[model samples]
Structures are given as C-alpha cells and as structure tokens.
Target: MAVTCDLSAERFVDRWSDYVGAPPLTCGIVDVGERTRPTVSGVDPDRVRTVSDPGNLQHLHDAVETHLSELPDADRTVVYLDTVNALLDHVPIPSVTGFLDRLTSSLSALGAVSCASFETGERGERTIRPVTETFGTVFELGRLGRSLEPTDDQLSSDDVFEVLSSRSQRLVLRSLLRAEGTLHVRELAQRIAAAQTTEQPDIEQIVTRLHHIDLPKLRETGLVAVEDRVVSATEVVTEVEPYLALAHPDERN
Candidate 1:
C-alpha cells in the first residue's frame, strides 16, 4: 500500500513508473491530505481510500483501520509513506512521534515494511533526535564523496529516478561525470547548451539557469557539488549511470 502524506499519487508514479509499470501493483493506494478523493485522474486503484482532514489524527487512524481490515493475508507487504515530516504541520512533535510509533508497530504486526521520508529542518535537531531514534534505519542525504564512483552507500532506485526526472539536472550530472575534477560553471554551461545542438549556445542564459535552478537541485540531491565557480560529480552520479545507459541503450557509456 502507498500512504501519501503531503504527496500526490500522480507525483509518486512519475518518480516510480519503472517499478509501478512492471509487475503491475495489484495493491492499494491511500491519499491522505486536503483532497478527499484521488487527485490524479486515469489511475483507478483496485482498493483505494482517502483521508482529507490532515489535521484529524482520528480520521487518519480510521482510514488505515479500514484498509488493514480489507487487506488479505500475505507474508510480505510494504507501505510507502511520503512526507512524514508534513505531519508536523498539523500535530505536535510528540503527537506525530506517537502516531508514527503506532503506525510502524501496526505495519510490523502486519509483516509490512514502512518506508517513510522526512524533510530536513521541519523539526529541530532536538525534536528530530527522538524521532530518528524510533526508526530502525535512517539515511542522511547530501553528503558527497570525492569521486563519482559507486559506493556501498549508493542511493535507492527511487532516489535515482527522482534525480533523473529533470533534464537540465541530468545534463549537469553527465557533464560532471565526464570531468576529471572540478569544472568551471561557465564551461559546464557551454557544454550543456552545446548538447542542445544550438549553433550559438547562449553562455549567459545557461549560466543563469544553472545558478538559479539546476545546480541547486543537483546539490540538494547530493549528485554534485558546486564550489566557488566550479562543479564536481559525486558518488550518486555513478549509481545513476546505469539508469542513464538504460534510458539511452543506443548510446555507449
């Protein structure tokens, strides 16, 4: 089952279409937010439910209870909950923590794994300490390695796909991956524009876009680092390298 907190089902599918398309999910999707019904059209889930009042924890509990009661016996199931941090918007930190405790416990009893995400700065370090301690595992994003090579701490397929969603970001990543070391922002911009097949690549426009959009995104995803006037790829680029190849099977890596 997919439990969307602040995220919509359409956005989720956009990021995980590769997994959702294959092995077609004969599953359920729960939309929990302002919208009382499914926000994305053309996706009629077999068993779907929605909890519109995000501020009402009781409403959320009731929705999950209905879902749990309807689910058939299975050895394994997974619950994906995006925007765990968004709960903080409606409830107190202690309340949200308690809610997660009960939810995770319920999933565990059902033999289902709970995969949740939390945005940084939604809660302070002190507030987050107990919350992080509750989870079995936690992943701290944005720490980059020296080289753009695969590592034990590789990103998940979901993370990789999310990063690849933006074409401009992908262009920046590929440029960084090919470079031996740091590349000046201007040099990187020229290459990206050149790849667009423009006879006169606009260096100024490309620089502006990278500075305002692409570079910030790459940094947020930990795919690349921007320092001074230069950029460099990180270990994440290597993890995504395979997917890029699959995306363009005709081209050699």
Candidate 2:
C-alpha cells in the first residue's frame, strides 16, 4: 500500500516499482491533495483512493485501514508513506508524529514493512526524531552521496587508488561528472562504452561489469551512490578528479 501526500501516486510507483514488485493480493493507494483519483499503472481503479482535503487525517487512516483489511499476508506487505512535509501543512507537528507512531505500531504488530519520507531542515529533524523512535531503520535520502561541503576525510587515499584503478571506473566518474553527477546504470554504461571503444560498445557486457565490479568499488569508497540502479556522484568526486589523470596506464607508477 502507498499513501501519498506531497508525492504523486504515479511518481511513487515509478521510483519504487523495481522494489515494490507484484503483490500476491490486491493493493491500494490513498492519494492526498488530489481532487480526483488518478489512474495508477498496474493497479485497479477501485483500489485508488483520493482525498482533496489534506487536513482529513481520519480519511487517510480509514483508507489505509481498508487496504490493510484486504491483504491478509502481513509479513510480505509493505506500507509506504510519502513526504511528511506536506502532511504537516494541515496537521500540527505533535499530531503528525502521534499519527506516525500509531501507524507504525499497527504495522509492526502485523509484521508489515513501514517506510516514509521527510524533507531536510529544522522542522524535519524535530518531527523525525520522534518518528524514528517508532520506525526500526531510517535512510537519509535526497542527499546521501552529494554533500554540500566536500572534504578529504570522506575518502581515503587507498580507496582513491582502488576506485580509480580501473579504466571503466574512471570513465564512469568522468561521465557522471559531465552529466552533473547522476545517471542510470544503463546510461552510464552506454556513455563509458561509447567512449572507450569505437565499434558499438557492447552495452550489456559493460553494464554487467559495472554492476558486478566497478560500481561497488566506487560506492564503497563513498565516491558514488548506487540505488535502484541509479548511480550518483558524491562531492568526493571533486577531490578525486585530479588523480584520475595520473592513474592512466601511461602515467601509472
């Protein structure tokens, strides 16, 4: 099940479709801030519920409860809630946190996975501190790899050598930097393959190597962020840029 307040239902599916996969039974979505229920792909229209009034917490809870009632296999189910930022516009911070606490506790009892998103700021932190106490794990999204302040401590010299050791990895970082630090794995492969080989770069082979080999190395070193097959460059890339040239076969020690 998905509950969207700031995020559109369609966009949520797009981002999470890979992980969400197909459920054994019918699923549902409660979209707040939409006047009419929008068509969501791979879902029955009847299952898509909408609330025009963002302040209607009861309606939101009822919609979620209705969906929970439909699916019996709680262990395999996932409940996703988008942006707490939008929900706060209508509900007070205390009420919002209380709602999340109750919602997560209920899902926990059923053994279903519960996840939610929140923006970054003083308000977000204040709300999330209480919310995090309810949820088991928290992921810092939107800016994991990209730090506003680039520092040398984020990446070690050994990590630098290892990540830039590969021609493909070097190509990956250069390409990502040029693309403004983010690209899907396939697109990143296409760009690198096209650069290294004049003949049509074997995209599948390149993609496989990146997945199994190059990307992990870069990701481990904090030089890149890999999520749902999307690779993003962290600010650490700026520190490593100069060394990429010296790591070339001709310049290597």
CA-lDDT, candidates in order: 0.71, 0.76
> Judged by lDDT against the true structure, how good is candidate 1?
0.71
Looking at model 2, residue 199 earns an lDDT score of 80
- Model 2, span 140-169: residue lDDT tens: 444555333425466766677777677788
Give the top-scoring candidate (lDDT).
Answer: 2
* Candidate 2, superposed: residue stretches over 4 Å from native: 15-26, 122-125, 142-253
lDDT of 1 by residue, 1-253 (tens): 6778777766665556656664224556678887746644344554678877677776776677567667766336777778777678888878878887888887777777776777765468977787776676566555452333435676655667777786777777777766764689999987788777568878899999999988887787777888798898876675676556445422223
Clashes of each: 0, 0
